[model samples]
Target: MSIWQDQHVTVVVSGGIASYKAIYLVRQLMKQGATVRVTMTAHATEFVTPLTFQTLTQQPVFSDEFTMQDPKHVGHVALADWTDLMIMVPATANLIAKVANGIADDAATTTILATTAPKYVVPAMNSHMYANPATQRNLAQLQTDGLQVLTPATGMLAEGYVGRGRMPEPDEIVDWLTQTLIDQQTDLPLHGKKVLVTAGGTREMIDPVRYISNRSSGKMGYAMATVARELGAEVTLISTPTALTQPAGVQYIEVLSAAELLTQVTAKFATTDMLVMAAAVSDYRPVKAVDQKIKKQPGQTGLTLELTETADILKQLAAQKTGQFVIGFAAETQHLLANAEKKLAEKKLDMLVANDVSQPGVGFNGDTNQVTLLTPNSTPVTTNLLSKTEIAHSVLTAAINRGA
Candidate 1:
């Protein structure tokens, strides 16, 4: 399930040109399955109407404490009580000052004051205003009051000046909020654990212009990295060439070849609590890479190149394993379980994820996969055809159950 499923999110929009952006943020939250209610400052309504937010959230937007739309209970207090998480997007300089000084003249401030739920403040203003001593002091005070404040992005502001104080993009805000919520769950299965994941297909250089690579799109590995982070593990993704975005809050290291992948994994193995080797490392590389691109002769009929074996990363990791739980992937076309089991035992892996690439929608370059989880002395658990994200959570759950 999505982390935001059934979550009650209260978005408090304050006055700023960035208030329009908050509409997009609210839309994203609802898309993630959050039941969102919006509270707008009177000035905020000038930027975006309450009717817009009310229509989008399918709930009444609270702007005044005296307004009695829900006659039975106080609107601000009721909303505050129902909120699981509260966020102030485009937290203007005035709102920050009011909040810091315990001022609650408006519905938004009143609800903020009433809620015991964790609060996240996203600041947005002119660069000079944000950098002012009073603003900085109030922000620091908010942190001291136990509120989480996201730093404003450094870029062009609404005033046509380029500097700090641009509100972060909607997607980035969602990612940050997601990570914050996940980190707050100390009881998550992988909490306090450090996970290292390798992703994408390694490229083996043959010449300046040519190389050997595989069809891996890195979707599965990227899913694993994202899920691991959501499970509260400190995740590091060592990746090869792929067109995927780096998962938020993950440490990303990009490498070019099997040799680089092996070196990076080896360096980090001892400190990691779990290792997921999902990358498709090239098994062979050209014996000697040409300094320049090999020219195609006009009359050439055939070309020959010598190849040599690349380092066996899994084997090397297995030999170096101390207390870390290691998981390996086997993408096979035949005898999938048998081959995966052999590798699991031979490489001392704690678990193995096996999938048949030949099957449609099962593996390699796809968003969906059907995988079998194999562990020492445990019955193989096969999952239904599911998205890579679902498969990632399943794999992590199995790993945790196996004492990873």
Candidate 2:
């Protein structure tokens, strides 16, 4: 959702057994929200057909400079101009040598020469071929030319021996690309800051099996974490068990009970710039938890368990906060604003989000949410029913506007 989203990525495929790996690379890029298009050398078709890549990207593959399908625009030049980022995968020795010396004979090399966008070169071939003096000189020249190049893996080759010059695994390549893109984006709003987010309903166990929790599905917290990440913050998501898939590029920590959640959040709070406490912490827990499951009495009509107050995580953490911007959530069935206002002032929170969970399509295990935003000495602002993602954006935008 950061650099890869809506990006115009051009993949240049050259000849090698590693050409097949490019397929997975394209798929991964698309998964990261990129608009991908592929260009291939004529020889690359022998290994992977153009139709394969065509079907994968749902865009025409460019392999020949001579083919003029569009009357108004030259093929390679148009592709070059359309590209925001270019990748050369399985860059064979022939292509590398040509690119090093500025030879533009085919569609792939011609587009590479014409495009002003950043180029990433991934070389794969025989170990001896990669070790040749000419190849070494060309590789160095590529670095000197300001292109990002990945060192090939030292592993088993198609020739059935272990050595260098194997293309890196597809997933590894995608990870490298993702990190590189994030590093390059210095102007992102939360670029250098750390954000801590807690999600889900904390469980307070009474026995081995029975526990106290809530209807919180962690959807709101997950959305907050994901949106914070998309805003370019180094996000840490501390969550209770849920069915949600963890967002990419964010650090994750797991906790089951309120005590564990408190420990993790407090441990990371010192370095955090902003904290969003979205998890529904249990108000009371069993006073004594037995190791084994509690059994029902033979003649008993009901069961009674002693309960005690759980730790006040938000109030404790916020009371000691120095420069950190702390945000807390309150779910009330009645007197939403009055109750929320009391807590907001008592906890000394920079922002408080209050919602009435009794409404439909709003809060607790649902994809949609409606909330009232409160800041110290300011009027409360209410939001219409919206998807959790939209609510997340609104909340973060308000925080940023308030200089959080």
Candidate 3:
């Protein structure tokens, strides 16, 4: 759900007791990296002060058409021209009718009517008013006018009655709006594509008490999943256990071992348009797992166990791929380029992301990394130290540019 970077969002608050909730909504949008500007109706300011929103957004709040702070440009026109997205929160019945009928009576409706950006409406009012025929007809008109509207949720209302017409909570609103924006951007490269990503280091079982694993904290893979979602892909993240929160808006699968990861990826591979194998799969595992914890021997100095090769996920997926674009990761402490090139060819991957884990803040558990992108017959492109999200964007952009 974390897609809104550099997006210009303009929120219009209308009159209602729910007007105050727009405060949290604006904050949520800004937290997702959006540049938010707020506009309010005169009735709305009765419930919440314009100064509150101005302080939260650190920008001027536009409330009245007659009160112009900038003499050089019409306030509504300038704001309308700058907005990439527009939202009408706590949209009262009066606001809905005005917008549906193209009435520009107040600063809120005037700016909303002037803006060509996609409009998203969230209505809040008495349940009976919401159920009225006029309101329903106006809402349908909004749909016909190509504006997106969120149905008010059902629950206890401010008037102490249980019914629909309550505006959604701040988090819920952000989630809905984020996905609605993604769905509307059909021109996005991965808009309709299904992307399967594997993350974290797989644990190879040794016994009930212990296992073999790596230092991978799954940050890189999670970042990839997040970025893929941002790019408009229907992303499914098959991840090993890691101390990271699951990224919202992506299907997540949890697995502990290399074999489990393989099974999950295989099940989704047939439908996947792109596959990012970011997982650091363990190469070897104990040949036999002890059902119970093994006890120390009294005099034995050393214990020996047989190890077997883990399944080669990349090579296997590469072999079975029909039209899917496969991406593999090479994490090496030494000989980064040489080792990466070898894996790229051997795995028959469409693209390979290679990094030197021995370098500071460059791989595994870290939030940042510097990686080289290798493709067949192309000069390797390496990144400076950057956040994993930035790296993910770089990697996806590279793959897309290469025909992924």
The C-alpha lDDT values of all candidates are: 0.94, 0.92, 0.93
- The candidate 1 region of ten consecutive residues with least summed lDDT is 315-324
Candidate 2 yields a Cα-based lDDT of: 0.92
Which residue pairs show backbone clashes in model 1? Answer: none
TM-score: which is higher, 2 or 3?
Answer: 3
TM-scores for every candidate against the unseen true structure: 0.94, 0.79, 0.84
Query: Candidate 3, overall lDDT?
Result: 0.93
Clashes of each: 0, 0, 0
lDDT per residue for candidate 2 within 1-404, as digits (tens), equals: 34578999999999999999999999999987899999999999999999999999999999988988697999999999999999899899989999999999998999999999988999999999999999999988998998899999999999999999999988778767776777687887778989999999999999999899999999999999978877778999999999998766789999999999999999999999999999999999999998998888799898889999999999999988979999999999989999999999999999999999988888888889999999998999999999898899889888988888
Model 2 scores a TM of 0.79
RMSD of each: 1.8, 4.1, 3.5
Q: Write the per-residue lDDT of candidate 1 for residues 1-404, one digit (tens) a residue.
A: 66799999999999999999999999999998899999989999999999999999999899989999889999999999999999999999999999999999999999999999999999999999999999999999999999999999999888887989999999999999999888788988889999999999999988998999999999999999999998889999999979999899899999999999989999999999999999999999999999998999999999999999999899888778889999999999999888989998998888899999999999988889999999999999999999999999999988998888
Model 2 regions more than 4 Å off: 14-33, 43-60, 88-104, 121-176
